[model samples]
Each structure stands twice: as C-alpha cells, then as structure tokens.
Target chain A: MLNFAPTQEQEEIRQLAQSLAMEQVRPQGRSAEQQGDISPALMKTLTQTGLTTPFPEEYGGSGVVEAVTYTLIAEELGFGDGALAMNIIGSLMGPLTVLLAGDKSQQQHYITPFSDASRGHLQRGSLGFAERTGGYYVTEISATIRTEGEQYILNGSKRDVIHGGQSSPRVVLVRLEGTSGTGGLCALMVPLDIAGARVSLDEGKLGLIAAPSAAYTFENAPVSATCMLGQPGGSGVLRAAALYNILRAGVACGTARAALDYAMDYARGRIAFGRPIVSYQGIAFMVAEMAMKLDAARLLTWRAATSWDRGTGCETLVQEGEAAQYQAIKIAKSATIDAIQILGGAGFIQDHPAEMWMRNAAAME
Target chain B: MIDFTLSELQQAARDYAHQVALEEMRPISLECDRTEKIPDSFMWNMQRRFWAGAAGQARTQAQEGEEKQDNILSILSQEEMAWGDAALSTAIPGPGLAAPPILSQGTPEQQAKFLGPYMDGQLHWGALALTEPGIGSDVAGMSTTAVLEGDEWVLNGHKHYITNGARSDLVVTFATIDKSLGREGIRPFVVPRGTPGFVVGRIEEKMGLRASQTAELIFENCRIPKDHLLSGRESSKKAGFKAAMGTLDATRPMVGALAVGIARAAHEKTCQWVQEELPKGFSVYKRREIELELDEMGQELEMARFLVWRAAWMADRRIPNSKEASMCKAYAGGLVMKVTSAGVRISAPGENSESRQFLQKWFRDAKVFDIFEGTAQIQRLVIARRLFPEVDIP
Candidate 1:
C-alpha cells in the first residue's frame, strides 16, 4: 500500500535538474549573491524546462507530478543556489493556486500564458496576504473590502509580498463587508495595471534578495464582479492560506537540501589535524544529525505533497501542511547552522556560501 | 562526510530482515522466549527459510556515494528483528559476534572460509571468544595462550560469558601469542567446530539474551592450521591484538543498537500500556513521569542512534570509526540499562504485568550491552585516550 519509490520519469527529471544545477546554477552562486540578482538566463532556462508548468498537459503543462519528484528537483536546484531557486520557484505558487481553484476559462486565460511560450502573455502574480500585524502569524485580516452593487472596492496594505512589482499580475485577500476576520476575507485577482494598485519593491531583505520581498498597497482599488475567485466571501482567503502552506513547505525543503549539501562538502574536504574534518567524531556526529533531520523533513514534505496529490480534504491536510512546513523550517534552520559549524570560522564570512545559506535558513525560522 | 541514507543494498537488508521478522520470527517470538530455548528444528527451519532467502538475494544495486551500506536501515532492521527476538536476530547466520573482523580485516580467503559458510546458511552458530574470567575489560591481562609449533598454532585459553559459545560451529578464539608484548601479543584464531583440544564449558545462566547460548569455552593446546591465524603476519607479533580490538570497533555499535531496540520496546510497551489503561479524561500522574522519562530517553536514543549510524556509516565508507563506535556503545549501553529498568519501574506493582510481556527480559537483556563489547569503563578509557592523547603517560 505504501510505494515510496520514485518513478522512472521522476528520476529522469531529477537527474536532469541535478545536471542543470551543477552546470548552470552552482558556478554562478557566488555571482548571484554578489550581484543581488539570480542570473535571468538561468531563470529563463528553468522556465523553458516547464518548471513554470509542471501540471496536467490539458492545462498547458506536463501531467500531474508527484511531490517527491518536485522535491527532488527543488533539492537539486537548492543544492546549487537556494537564493536563485527561491526567486524562480517562489513565483510559481500563484499560478499553481489558480490551477487549483480557478474556473476553466480562468486557467486558459491566466494560467496557460505562463506555460506556452508562443502565446507571449506576460503574466506575473504574487499572493498578498501577510499584513503588518504585531506578530508573524497571518491569522488576522486587517485589510478591508467594500462591495458595491456591480463592483467591489478594496482598500488595505499587504506587507512582505514577494515580487511585488508593477510588472506582475496581483492577487489580494481583503476582508469583505459581511465577513469579519477569517470568515470575512475574500480573494480578488487584479492586474498590476489596475487603478489605485500601488506596487513597492523592497530593496533589502535579510535573505532571498534575488526575489524582492516588497509591500503592496491597494487604495480603494476597483475590482470587477467576476474578479473574485472561489466564493465571494471567505473561500479566497482560505485558498491563499492553503497555497502559502504548500509554497512554504517547498521553500523549507529547498533551503534544507542546500544547507545539507554545503555542509557535507565542507566536511569532506576541509582538513583539520591532518585529515578531513569529517574524520573527527565531533564533526562526523553533526553530519549524521544533518542527514537524519534532512531525511525526516523530506519525508514529511513528501507526505504532505502526497496528501494534496490525492485530493485530501482541507481539514485533513491543514495539520499535515503545518507539520511539513514546520519541519522544513526547523530542518533548514538547524542544517544551515550546522553547515556553518562544519566550516568553523570560514563559514562566518560572506565570501563563503554557508553564511548566506545560514541567513536564508534563519529568515525561514 | 558520511551520509546515512538507505542504499539499495541496505534497503534489501531491511526488507529481508523485516520479512523474516514478520513471517518467521514474529510468529514464534513469544513461544521461543517462553520456552527459553530455540529448538534445533526451528533454528534450522530459519536457516533454510529466512537466512537462505536473505543470503541469496542479489547484491547488485545503485551505489549512491561513499556511504555504501545503510547503517540506519540495518539498525532499523535490527530493531524490527529484535521486535521479533533480539537473541534470534543476533543468532541469525550473518555475522553473529565473530564475523566483524572477517568483514573488516579478513583476507579474501578468510572471508570465503569463515563468512561464506555463514552467508550460505551452511553454518548457524559462531562466537567471538574474547573475554576471559579474569580479564573483563583488559585484553592485555588475558591468560589465554597460543604458541607457534612448527606449522600448527597450539592454543590454550578459557573464554567465559561467550554468547552462542556452546553451539558455535566456528569460534574466533583469542590468545596471547607473545606474553612479553602485553596487549600487542594477542591473536585471534578460527578454531573449527570439532577441534580436539577445545572444550565446551558450562553455559552461564543469564538474565537476558536467553535464546542465544552463553557458555564457558576452554581451550587446552587446541591446535589448528597456521592459516587460521586471522590478520597475523609473519613479521609482526602485534597483529593479533590489533585484530581483536578492531573487532570491537565494528561490533560495538551493532551491540549498542540492540540496546536501542530494547529501549524502544520498553518505551513502546509503556506507551501501549498507557493507551490501554488510562481513562479518557483521567490523566495518570505516573504517565506524566513516564512521559518525562520517555522524553529524556528519546533524546538519549536519538543521540545513541546518531552515534551508531555514524560508526556503521563510517565502516560502510571504509573509514575508521573506533572512537565513534566506542562512544555509541558507552552511551547507549548505559541508556538501555537505565531505560529498561525505568520501564520496569514505570509499570510497578499492580499496574502492569512484566511476566506477560518481555519487559522484564528486556530489563535483563540491557545489562549485557554495557558489560560486553568493551565495558562502559573501557569505552570511557578509549574516549579519554582519543580525546587527550597526552593522557596516557609512557
């Protein structure tokens, strides 16, 4: 009943991703960090591989793929450069959300463009849900939305929005008139060019600089009646929350894998007392720990993915989602810290990738 | 760095052990323990049914990296196997206590002669005859003697507390080849099943590890071919001691994992008991104490697991893991004893039935882990020597 083996095609994809990572992503890791932008060429190469479209072929993408396969790809990419992988894969969440919840027409119009190259549709979307609340938990919705007879106007600010630039399409979750707090919130999809939509790109962040983590301000933004996704009331917010959980899980896996690879390589090569530092029991013990945690985190993430792949109900998967996300973050934080520890003083410097990985891990925590 | 992932080979190992545990051992587990004996028929039945299947399985698989074998999977398999019966799992026809040296330092000829027969299930019993009555932790003080006589090596030693000692078809017997060299003079020789001078002494009445026989082995001028000298070189008298100690380096962690398995059984047993006994809302006070103990036990188990996996992983990678191996043994041995005793104490008086299950046996079984395979005291000495090379004065 439990067949955890990766399919042949999935393995092929993993090998392909690994090759791409070593040949393209790894060599440019330092440059990406120094330049504050993951090479656009690499992003295009990834997009061309249909990373932007790894779903059902009918939706203009490959047929549905397993979460393990997805994780394998993320791990390989992450092993190369976590910051770059985050920038590229972080953008895929919005489209995946639409693919999950949108009507067929919406998929054809909004989702398909990101997939088919010949269509030449410039579609970019970011989830706008995190508010400037007192705490990190996104439980409270302070943004407000007023419904008019034929149209609704939204007015609120979303903080920590990734890739929140004017060039991309936007989705915002605002508290509607009838719904208050969680129940009151609804998701509205709007183009970046829409009236009263202000996009502010954050110039700085503790980590993941390649993908701008910015803020979005919607000042009485006019939205059409059909612009509302799922239900008019709270369905949209719930969908966004669900999407965030999955994306965060993916992020955690990627970052942890990266940290593990970095730590392992450092342990194997760096010499202390005339042999590989890994030869020492203290260092070897930590390496063993990293391996254990990384594997457990991956399994948890895969389990969560499998749940979603099987179309598990929202209630059944939310806890699994939380577990997967929590483990990923925990693993990433711990692995990267150990990665730095393996490198000792060298890991503390900016010239080395371990410090950056550590930063990325901390940011996730 | 060693990565402790389950290689295909290790997965094969896990699958094999898991199947044998479920199909054969698990079915007869309680009966075997209750009888305090593994019948020759059942033991032979396992040799053919389980060991034959396991030994014949194809070894070819994808090698991921330097970490060749799956230590964790092996440990997991051992845990599963122990779940069936640790004594039986330990007695399985793979390594038994004696096979590590052959696996680690044996020549191809040595492997073919010793390890091959066991792998084929042609032989079921083997014992590492190291500890003597007088020398528990000190190998240098061992009174066992083996002297070169023309082409054959004459051996005389009395090894006690040897597991499967009474039944072993092949015994890796240790003796002092040169008394002047102290610990360096020790040598291990594979004295075959029916050697004339070697005698089976009384099997000790042990607290646990009941399914596996523990006996006293006496060797009086037990003679064997010169080739029986394991890892012994014509030029070096120190060969024997290194080989004997080296065996401990590899087998200690496996022994440690046995402790882990016992502790796991105890923890799992307590958890199952809590679920069965406690009311819906009436929380038991002892359960809170048990949970707190379990928390500490879990952390200790995790740390122990890491050490075992690390040493096993290193062995798979062909790296020396003497220090890590010692650490796991030292820590986990102590942990299992504490955890098992706590398990017995946790279910004290009328609340639980120790005799009904194997908790009492587990409590009895955990004591040997620390005492055997280089005692906790020996491990500490090894750790101290490794940590501070200057500690040992000339």
Candidate 2:
C-alpha cells in the first residue's frame, strides 16, 4: 500500500489533539514549566482525555492499539507542553511494560491499577532506563538484581527518573548479577512504597522543568519472585526497553514539529530589508531545511510506531527503535537551532515559545 | 490507511528489477565506468525487458485487478536498477528524463507529437533542458527566451549540464517569452535536434557515473513551430515555474530511489564484508560493535526508502506532495552520502578490499545525487515554500 495518510481513527484523534492543544494544553505549558511540577488539574485533564492511560479494552482503558495514534497524541500534547506531555504520557512506561510482556498476575496488579482514573484515582508512574553513571551505556546499567531463595534483591540507584519522587509504581532495569550484556538485563516491577526504597527530593536540571524528575535508591530491597515481568529471563525487558526508545523518539518529534511550526509562523510575518524575512533565501532555506528534517523525523517515528503496534517481534522493535531514535535526536537539535535562528533576536527571549522548545528538546537525548 | 506494504505486483517488479540489476547491470558497470561509455546492448536489452514486464503487468492488471501501486513500484524499480549501477538506470534508452514534464503538463496532442519519437517503438532519448549556466534552481530567472514570429517561435537560450543531452533527439526546453513576467513568462517547448541554431556543446567529464555523459546545449535563435509550446499557449509567470516544479515533484522521488540504490549497494557490501570477510579472531565486543553499526546502517537505508516510497505514492495518487517530494530528496541525498562513506570505511582491509574499491567508486557516484534535480539546499527551499506559503519566495 505504501500510504502515509492516517487512518480515519488516527485522523479523528489528531484533530481532537489539535483542538485540545490549542485550547487546553498549550496555554498552561509556560506556567507548568515555571512551577516545576504538573498541577493536579492538568493531570486530570490529560487523564480524562484517555491519553494518560490508553490501553486495551479489557485493561479498563481506551483500546488504542496503534502506536501511530499514540505518537500523534504525544506530539500534540508535547506541542502543548513537553513537560506535561511527559508527565502524563511518560507515566505509561510501567503499564506499557506490563502489557508488552508481563504475566497475567503482574498485569492484574500493575496494569489494572492504571485504569484507576475512570475508577476515581489519579496516580502516575515512571520507568527508569537511564542511570547517571558517567560514560556508561544502557547495556552497562549499574543497578543490579540478585536472586536469593524466592526473593530477588534489588540494589543500586536510578537517576533522572521521571516522577521519581512520586508515590507510584515503576520498573527499573537491573543487571542480573553473574551475567553480562543484554542477556543479563532484567526488568522488575517495584511498588513505590516498597520497604528499603528511598526517593530523593525532586532534582532540578536542564530543560523539561515542568515534569518532576529525580533519582531513586533501593537498599537491599527484596521482592517476591512474582514481581519479575514476562517469563524467566530476557523477555519483557527487551520489549520494554525498545518501547521506551520509541516513546522518546515520538516525544522528541513532538518538540521538533512544534518548534518548526512556530518558526515558520514567525518567518511569514517578520519583515527585513523591505519584505518578509521568509522571502530571503537565507531565511527561506533555513525554514525549508527545518521542514525537511522534521518530515524525515516524523517518518522515522511513524515507521517505528507502526512496527511497535504490530507487536511482530523483538527484532522488529529493535530495528525500528534504532531507526527512530537517531533521527529523533538529530532532528530535535537541528530544529531547535533553526527555530531559534529563524526568530533571530526575538527567539532568544522567553516571550516566544521557541526558547522553551529549545529547553525541552535538550532533555530528549 | 498508513500502510507501508507494497502490493503483490510491486513486489514482483522489485524482484525482477533486482535480478536485472544484479545480473545485466553489475557485470558491465565497472567496464562502462572505466570506458566512460554507455553499454548500449546492455541498456537496451534491460530497458526492453523492464518495459515488457511493465506493459504485461499493465495489460493484465487493468481488467478486474484489485489495486495497483504504480508510483511506488516505479520508485522501487528505479532503486533496484540503481543498486547494480547508478548509470544503468539513467542511461537506459528511454524517455525517462523527459516524460515527467510531458506527463505532468503537456496537452494530449503535444504529448503525442513531442513524445512520439521515444514512445513509438523507437530507441531514443528525450531530455528536459532547464538548468542553464547562469540559472540553476532559479528556472524563472533564465536568460533563455522565445519570441513568437507569426506561426514560428524563435527560441534563444543556452543550457548546460543536461543529462542525455548530447544525443537526445527531442528536448523539452524551458524558455521565457518575457523575463519580466518572471515565472509566468517561462514555458516549455519541444525542440528537435535538427532545429536550426540548436547545437550540442562539449560533453562533461565526471568524477563518477562516467558511463552517463552530460552535454552542454546551445540554442541561438533556434526556431520551431509556435505549436511546439508545451502547454499550447504562452505561459503566465506562474505556469512555467509550476510546470518545472511539478516535474521535479514527480521525478525527485525516483532520484531519491536512485540514491537508495547507491546506499543499498554500499550497505550490502559493508554487511557482506563484516559477515563473511571480517576476521573470525575478533573479540565478542568488537563483533558486537560491528553488529550494532550494521544494524544502524540497515535502519537508515530502510527509513530513507520509506520516505521515497511515500513521496512516490503521493505523486501517483495526485496528492499535493511538494513538501514530501523535497523531503525525500533532501533526506535521501544526505543519507546516501553517509551510507557510502560508511561503506568505504568498513569495507576496507577485508578480503583484499575488493568491495572497498567499488565502494569508493560508489561514494564518488553518490555525491551527485544531492547535487542534481535540485541540490539539497534547493530542495529544502522548495519544502520551505510549501511549509510557509504566506510569503512569496523567489
């Protein structure tokens, strides 16, 4: 078929997203950034929209199976506000993991809890794929999970955990001591209130400020063997990891598209040398390059999203993830720089959304 | 419905083209590159087989066929042919270089008469002569002019760097009747090779794709019937530029597809080397690093191919794909350069670097993909215009 048009459902979702972004999401983006925390009201809005917990019908949520639609929603919310988008959608890491490879019991516990919004609660969660061990790669996650009898002992700390300080469940990547590389990697569902688990004060850092983020440390935290996701080993971890990458790519694409759209609007009316700046090749070409890069990024993300939706296999996920992430980072950086350039002096000022986008884009990679 | 799957017929075309590229094209690719001459027998034979399959598919499928993805199929076919050799795809004796414009903007009578030589059972080439020495991407700012002299039009213009120009018997020449009218004044005219004052200049020497010779064309007050005007009337300022851009919009994906070819060749070569030729003595970590790099390469090429196919599909469906067209060309142009450079870097010191040597040639060949049919910069500018249409851009 080789078609790039969205399905009817996707189109309807995107249209809904557009209106919600313009009316609800975007207006509060700046204030949220300043507050350094997502307001409960905004979280309620997102949750009510079903974006916060879209899952299968049986899972007590919207049965939005298509990753493509998820990305569209991510982009819109991200465009509205990157931090809030992350706050709302980023919390999906725990539930997504459960659905991807979790056992029935694990799904009943962790996943069923997500549909809490419709049932009157508004809890949020996070998944930690990154740890700030300078020069360490994902394969070298320092967090370790050791087996002792029927319990898996979890140690080490996770850094840059979104909603880290919040009282919500999460999944952390841990090395299964005595094993190395990806084969040794394991994902376990750790309830936020588990004993011996410590949450640090919200850490302040570069960009994406509206979303609360920090570190978590577990001191000899022991969990029943049932806490582990998927089968015995190396099952759900890979799919979860791959989904994380695709989600990041999709979010990154959101900020990039937003930046480019804002810059194009600026270029159209901003005049220089007796005409709109866009008429000049220097500016026109820059905007053009930004659009081209954005398109490429979107295509890569959508391709990855579709593949993930298929749930074909881990190999497909890894392939699409690799494709999506590279372009996401590259385009995000390029788009922000160009968006700022197109605005000239005005871009550097906080009065415009471009600077905000630049800050949000930095947190992506 | 947001599908990336190629139809069954398209898959057949792709497989057939892949075989031709591997068999008919690859064996003569190096020799043709070395000699800087078109392999006529190979080009003609492959074109015959290619078109014969295309014709057969068209005839059988139009009656009670389910669905056809013509543009994407064409794009994939271009890619497969290019994989064997970038030259073979372009140098194939056909009206490829000219058909886009005629198909996009020509009147039925004009198309029949102007395209007859190439389409009507004749082994010939037709060219779209647009780029001039002074004006490259700025088609409207051209120095070429056409002044109607009663029933005849006297055309005066100079075009260089024309593909299939030297030997093309028919050319779709873009000349402005009034430069002040800017884009509107420019129009395409069908100029036969024997038209008085129409001269073929020197053929260009190149760094790569040597088998396809580029020609410089000189038209000094060349006269042709007024009816030779491609649109059957003097173009408004917008008409000429739009027509040319329309042509690029349709053809750029094929160009992008060609880039995918070069990238595929480089990617395959690198993969083959890393898999077959790399020393088995390497450590697990080293092997993993190579494996990751290979995975990245495959991902990049496939992503680029998706963009190309999407653009082609839009064109086939008559969707306004100006942004997409430029996006694919721009992305593929940059990506092919990256892939080929990687090909050269990784294929070296493997099995005596035989593939590495060819990869170096492919690298040189890949450079022009970004330069022609609108350089990467030009494509971006076009894309920008579509993205921000509020301001009229030159």
Candidate 3:
C-alpha cells in the first residue's frame, strides 16, 4: 500500500489551499511584510476556509485535527508567502497544544474561541516553547514552574513567542521546581493578561515581518492549577513540541517550492547569449537541484505528518518530525539562495519575490 | 493516501538481502577491496542464489497477478546488499546495467538473445557502454562509429569506465553512424563479448569499490548482425538519446540506493563506535554537539532514502520520472559524500578496528556515487531540462 496519491478529499483541500495561495496570499506577501501584519481581509479569507479552526466539534471547530490536512494547508499558504503563512498556521500553536495536552475543561476554555468564525482570524494563539539561552533539544529548556497551593507559579522568559503580545491564552514549557532535564518538564497555559506577566512585541527581525512575535517575561505569574497541560512530568509537552516542528517543516517545504517555481519561470523567460538562460546548464542545473531538494523536503514533511496522524509513539514522532524540520529548513535556505542566484542582479532587489523568499527563508531557519 | 510501508514481498526481499549482505558479503568485503577482485566461486554461488530467489519472485508475481514491483524490489535489495559492501554488491553476477535498455528498447528477439542467459542460473554480466575516454556527460558528441556493411553493423570505438565491461557476456555499445547528425545518428548495438575485435583493455585501479571491475572496452572493427540494433529500426532523431536517457532514468535511483546503503553503513558504524568506545569523560557539551551531528546524518540518510524510493516507485508505476530519477541520484550522490565524510570525522580519535578501517573505505567508495551513472552536475542538467521543457537544453 505504498501509495503517493492523496485521497479525493485531501486533493480537493489541496486545490482549495493552492487557489487561495496563488489568488490571495501571494499577492499580499510584499504588502504584509511592509506593513508588518497580514491584511484583515486576507485573514478573514483564511479563517473562512476552516483551516485555522482544527479542534473538537463541541469546541467550535471542524473537529478534524488531522496533521496531514494541516500540513497540506500550511504548505500551500507557505507557498503564497512564508510570513503570512506563519501568521495563519502559527495561530494553531496555542489551541493545538491545549487540544493535545490540556484536560477536557481546558480544551473547552482555550479552543472554543478559535471556532468563533467572525473573530477567528483575529484570534491568534501562541506557543512559548523557544528560549533565548537553550538549544532546540527539550533538555536545554531552563524555564521553571512551581505549584503553590491551588495555583502554579511560573517564572521564565520566552523569546520568539509567536503572537505573544496578543491577549489570547498561550502555552509555555517550564521545568518543574527542583527538577532538571526532560523528566521535570511541564506545559502551563498562561493568559497573557494575567498578573506578573509582561509581553513586549519584538521591534525588529531579519525576516518573517508579517507575523510579529513578542517576548514574554513571567515573574511569579500565578495560574490556576487547572491550567496545567497534561501532568507535570508527562510527554504531552514533548508531543506538542514535535508537532510544532512538523508543521513548520510543512511551511518550509512550501516556501522552498515557491522559490523554485519562481526561479524556474524566470530562467525560462530570461534569455542570454542568444538563448533562454534555462538552456544553459549553469542556470538550469541550479533550478533542477532546487526542485529536487524541495521535493525531498516536502516528502519528508508529508511522511512525518502521516506518522503523527497514525498515532505513532512519541519518540518516533519527535525523531521523524524533527528530522523533517531539519531538512526542510536547509532546503528553504538553499532554494532561496539558488533562486536569487538564478535571477542575478534582478534577484537582489524587491521587484521579484525571490529576494523576499531569501529573507523569509533565513528568518525561518 | 501517501504511505511509506513496503509490501510484504518487498519487506521479505529486503530482509533476505540484509542476511546475504551480512553473511556472504561482509566477510569477504575487505579482502576483495584489497585484492581488487571478487572470487569467481563467490560470484557463482551468489548468482545461483539470486536467480533462485528471482525466479521464485517472478513466479509469485505472475501467479498473483501483481503489478510489476521489480524497481522497488531492486532498490530495496540493493540498499541492503550495498550496506554490506558496495563493491561486492555491484560485482554480483546478473544483467547489471544493460537490462533496462534491452528490456525497454530492444526487439523481442534481441531481448531473448541478449538477456535469456541471465535466467539460466549461471554467472553472467551485461553492460551498457556509453561513456568514452574523451566524453562522459556529452553523450551526443561521442566519436564511436557504427557503419553498415551488408547485413552487419561495424563498430569502432573505445568505451571506458564501463562496469562489468570486461566480464559481461554482452555489452550494449553506443556508436554514431554520422557525427554530423549529433544525437540523431547515434545507435546502440548488442556486441557479444567474443565478437571479433571487441577488446577488454586495462582494468582500472580505483580509490574504492575496487572489487567492481571498471574496464576500457575497445570495439575495433567489431561487427554484429544488423538485427543486433536495439528496436531493429533506423535511428530516429530522439530514439538513441531517449533510449540512453531512459536507461539512466530507470537505473539512477538504484544507484542512489547503493549510495544510501553505503552512507547508512558508515553512519551506523560511527554511531556504534561513539556509543561503545568514546571516552566516558567526554564533556556533555561536546557529546551534545556530536549527537546533533549524528542527528543530521540520520536525517539526511532518511531524506536520501525517501528520494530513492519515490523515484523507484514512480518507475514501477510507469510514470514519466526522468526528473525524479535525476533528483534522487543527485541528492543521494551529494548526501553520501557528506555523511561518509562526517562518519570519518566523528569516528576519529577512536580505536583503529576493522570496522573503523571500513569507514575509510566507504568514504573512498562514496565519491563515485556522485560521479557515475551521471555526475551530480549532469543530473542537475537533466532535472533542469525537465523542469523547463521549453528551454531546450542540449
């Protein structure tokens, strides 16, 4: 049963996403990056597609929560524009975390708002997993959380918190008090407006400008004990983290694909020495390698996503998901660089999407 | 419905190949590399076993009315066989690289004449000779000439770097009838090993995969019946080039699989050394760095395998996969070089055991994966032409 074709419904979803990407998302990429935010209209269109509302049906969602579907949508949106795609797909971090690690009551509380169609586009959820000091490995996280009577006291600073400045609830990984390494890890849902919690929007970034990020400083921020996701020493947080990597890999694949297509088109049209530039092995080979790498990255992402949906063990999920992310990031970086190289002087400027993709690819890495 | 699971038959083939690799190949691997030859007894024994298994599988497929899984089966088994030793794996007695063109482009009579002996459970090899001493990737510019005289075709040329060329029972030789016609005048003829004036010249001494013989074949007034021409027809402008490319497309992924197998072997060996022999006092930070490096290696190997599998799968389904085939070969070619290089670097400052020695051998063997079948650059050219079909790259 080693099949590579998507199911009918998945194909339909792919078509819908691809159309949205080309018709709407791609056109607004430059403007969104310039304005440092996605246009509300485009956001609305994304929301109406029901891609951003993956949760339990009772919690005002389509209730599909399928990793494959999510990845497919992410790739298409990413193809449109990496930053805007992040703006849309990154919104899933918080709600998805709650659905995966939160208790039923927690899921109802945090995920219901996402399904509110009218405000869904504006309802962004953030995941505070990255740290300024630690390596990407879970054991390197230094943030801490402690239980005090009926509340959990959180004390940590998280950098690169996507949508961190927003009012929506967010999930942050923390080391349990007096514990170290992965065994001591916990995920706690923190409402950004809570006491002793401060959120500041990051002013400057190398890329991904359309999806603004914030830094979170929690100094003894108190949260109700019910807000704890899964158990204090459970694998829930690990699963959530792994899923994040897979999703990001999907976006990376999309961005790389975009850069490759754009470069191939340019090479086909741009003539040199009495022939199209693509006729020259110099330029054609670059495009070909880009296409191959992009395909390789996408296939890896898809495999990882499928593994997640099949309820594979947490260890396997983390390994496959992270591997996919690693390759996708590398491909995105190289594909954009090659695309720029193919375009020559014209690629250095903003007239074409190649330069923007290069910057976006860098930021993604 | 994108699934990565192997069918029952493919899995069985893979497992069996792994066993053969471990038992039959690994023991002789180092010695063969040193001596630059695989024992004839070893080749014959392996050949007998291979034909038995192949015949069984063919019968099973025919009985079950299964879709052709030969491509998938070949790659799956190739990876494992190569994991034991890439050189010995190539040295295995079979049709080698000539099967694709004969099966795809040759007339039924030609196929029967050239390929029938491979099924007799005897040691035999078939080769595809395209690269010459002066030309590698520019296949259309080859100077090998084939001129018609009566009912026979006379070929005069030198083809070098031909795997199994010296021992092959038949070599599918490429020659140009008219150099001025460029690719159009090219033709491939089945030149039997004993055909008059078909000479096997010096066997190359290589950095790695030395057990796999590379021969310089000279066709000096070598003549064969006109019917020996694949497809038994006058050369169409695209036929010769297309047939050669078609052969590469079918075989390139299998080559990629061999590279993956070698990389996996090196990576696995390095991992074992690090786990078992590394100094206990190695700093945690340094250990983590090594772990990250290993992680990247594993990821890259997985990516390369996926590419190889997809390409093989596409070929099985009869899908036009020229670009995909090149993609897998190009990616896997570069990937093996990187992984094997890392293997040596990470495994350094450790015991100089036999396994560690093999690591160096693998690093040497890894280079040709990127160089042969199609060099990495040539693969990109093919891929680019596919990507922008309108560009008309020569």
Q: What range of 10 consecutive residues in model 2 chain A has the weakest lDDT sum?
A: A131-140
Candidate 1: tens digits of C-alpha lDDT, residues B209-319? 777777899988888998888862435666677778777876777887777777777777766665675445545775687676676565456556656766666665557
Quote model 2's TM-score: 0.90
Q: What is the TM-score of chain B in candidate 2?
A: 0.93
Our model 3 lands, by Cα RMSD against the true structure, at: 2.5
Best by TM-score: 3
The list of candidate 3 runs beyond 4 A from truth reads A175-185, A193-195, A232-236, A271-275, B53-55, B62-65, B232-237, B279-287
Instruction: Choose the strongest candidate by lDDT.
Output: 3
Per-prediction share of native contacts kept: 0.00, 0.76, 0.76
Can you write out model 2's per-residue Cα lDDT over B15-70, one digit (the tens) per residue?
88898888888888888888898756875785577556664565367334654455
Per-prediction DockQ: 0.04, 0.57, 0.68
Off by over 4 Å in 1: A1-42, A49-52, A55-66, A100-104, A116-280, A291-328, A342-346, B1-79, B91-124, B128-151, B155-162, B172-189, B193-220, B225-271, B279-350, B353-394
Model 1 earns a TM-score of 0.61
For all predictions, the C-alpha RMSD in Å is: 8.9, 3.4, 2.5
Candidate achieving the largest DockQ: 3
Compared with the true structure, what per-residue lDDT tens digits does model 3 show for residues A1-365? 56677788888988999999999999999999899988988888877877678777888787657888888888998899998888776678888888888788888888888888787777888888777786345666788888789998888888877787874667788889888655677778787778998888988788888988888888999989877887787777777877888889988999999998888888888988889888887777777777887888888888888888888877788778878887898999999999899889999988998888888878774
List iRMS (one decimal) for every candidate: 10.8, 1.7, 1.3
| CA displacement after TM-score superposition, residue A49 of candidate 3 (Å) | 2.2
Error of 2 at A289 (Å): 2.0
Task: Tell me candidate 3's interface RMSD.
Answer: 1.3
